[model samples]
Target: MGSYRWNWPILLADPYYGWIVSGFGNTCLIAVLAWSIAFPLGSAIGIARTTELRPLRLVGTIYVEVFRNIPLLAQMFLWYFVVPELLPQDWGHWVKRDMPYPQFLTSVLCLGLYTASRVAEQVRSGLEAIPRGQHHAGLAMGLTPAQVYRYVRLPVAYRIIIPSLTSDFLGVFKNSSLALTIGVLELTSQARQIEEYTFAAFEAFATATLLYCAVTGIVILAMRQVERRTRIPGTIAIGAQ
Candidate 1:
């Protein structure tokens, strides 16, 4: 029945402070590890989707559609709870009980694969943005399609898409909060834990919010520098502010 009181100092107290730090560390770890998976896998899928072969492209398309359409929280649950049961008995037991950091690994995998679908679309669009003339010229120069992608088309496409990829990269950090659903004890989960114990809901989550903003701010600055360096002449950055 009393007015809510703010206690900002509690955020700096011992275990609570450690929780925030650990949560921040886990958040960063998840985002980076997930991106490691998303970048290459998505890039490969995108490339596959763009190729002349119909079956390969179809497979890539299906992967994108399935992952993209489903909600991420559902994917997290499926990976952590359902996939283990689907595995063989011994392996399933190992995954559910004995695997190292199972929650962390599962969260990383689910988030990575989910983000990969979006990244695949980005990559596909980036590749398609290349002019047909370059593709034809590369072929005329006796370059294999793969070689053309390696030497000419991919280089330009990557440069053209750096800004877009930067957004995708930032998205991983925000999306990673969903890891809390799988008991990953990530940033958002830690914030909730702090609230449960201290009842300082505002302080706990305000700290988490500030931490997220700080991380994203750094990422934006770094990626902007990268985009500036990698920008191709005569091509405007697609989503520059």
Candidate 2:
């Protein structure tokens, strides 16, 4: 048998090979969509976790434990397969018919919740790190609880926690590969297809590594830019003092 040559031009032009680009696009889409949901939800969960109300704290704890402990792959499988069956018969039928993208939805929900647990923890830590005087000052300024969080607590907490949040985003970007297990056709999944068709393990994997690195590098760079733009020079100094 002749050695199969790597054809760069063919890789670029072939639609099947184009799946790699499309896969990266799809992966980015999923990550953004999941984060959009996760950020607000995670912030709320974090607040609940820190609330003075005992019941809200309990609910937040349970939410974090349930989502965080469960494997995300298992959650995806549950959402895609088990949920429809477990629903009421009419609802199941409706979901089966109307749910055009069950796998994608499952991927988003699972990824969002998984990431949110982490974000929740980050937010909680950020809140705890804030001086108690900040909350007191907000109250003294006649801010409602909501106003206190909105105007004072969140601003400081976010500033303090951004470095941690950047790490979390990078982690989620990589973890998105898990969606391929449920047929979401992300970068890794597309690479598998290329390997199947060309039997070019080295080429296929090499392409994937470069693509992932490019995306991950961009995210890191963007986060660093955000950090530099928003950073307060005296805040860390003040905290230390």
Candidate 3:
């Protein structure tokens, strides 16, 4: 066999080192902000969709249908490039000049809104899955509508929806990579930088794939723990024979 050569200098001297770290940092930041925004908005929209108020339900339905039907890439592009132009000229200029990390912000908004649509559907379905008797008992207890939801409906709905929501969270995390197209410099972008600098396509791509797999695996494991702890009492255990 030829002499094994592990070039430490080549690894250390890779020109895109800064890009790799920066991209990973931005990916995490974007995913966190987007999830923070999406969860609350989605919960609210879901509650609205199930509310007695026709107007609120209609509005929620429209929002869900519109965003859910559209592509996330299109949503990001609209927020970043198209939204400013459609605004009044002075406001457009102000937005362009004043918005720090505009691509980051756009990624968050787009991902949050898009993911919220899916979440609303999940929450709605979860709420419906619970027995109607629970709501009747809450009302009979003289609980206000808000109280009924807070103390009864929402908790159970959320518990029931955990599995689906876990999947949604994973989807949001993966979609965060698309932010790179608008210059958010996430993991995939970092991998590209490494590839360009070292011309070691296999190594760079392998590193990126492993990193993503690790991140995803950790999230899935954490969510499984949550599922176990929060599971409805006396229900058959998930993954049980």
Best-performing candidate as measured by TM-score: 1
Clashing pairs in 3: none
Candidate 3 per-residue lDDT over residues 167-200, each given as its tens digit? 8988888899989889887988888877786766
Candidates' C-alpha lDDT:
0.92, 0.83, 0.84
Candidate 2: deviation at residue 194, Å?
A: 0.4
How many pairs of residues collide in each model? 0, 0, 0
* lDDT per residue as tens, model 1, 1-241: 3798989999999999999999999999999999999999999999999999999999999999999999999999999999999999999999988999998999999989988998899999989999989999999999999999999888988888887888898999999999998788888999999999999999999999999999888987888778777778766653344
Residue 120 lDDT, candidate 2, scale 0-100 = 92
Cα TM-score per model: 0.96, 0.91, 0.91
Q: Compared to the true structure, candidate 3 yields what TM-score? A: 0.91
- Show the colliding residue pairs in model 2: none
Error of 1 at 114 (Å): 0.6
Compute the lDDT of residue 101 as modeled in candidate 3.
77
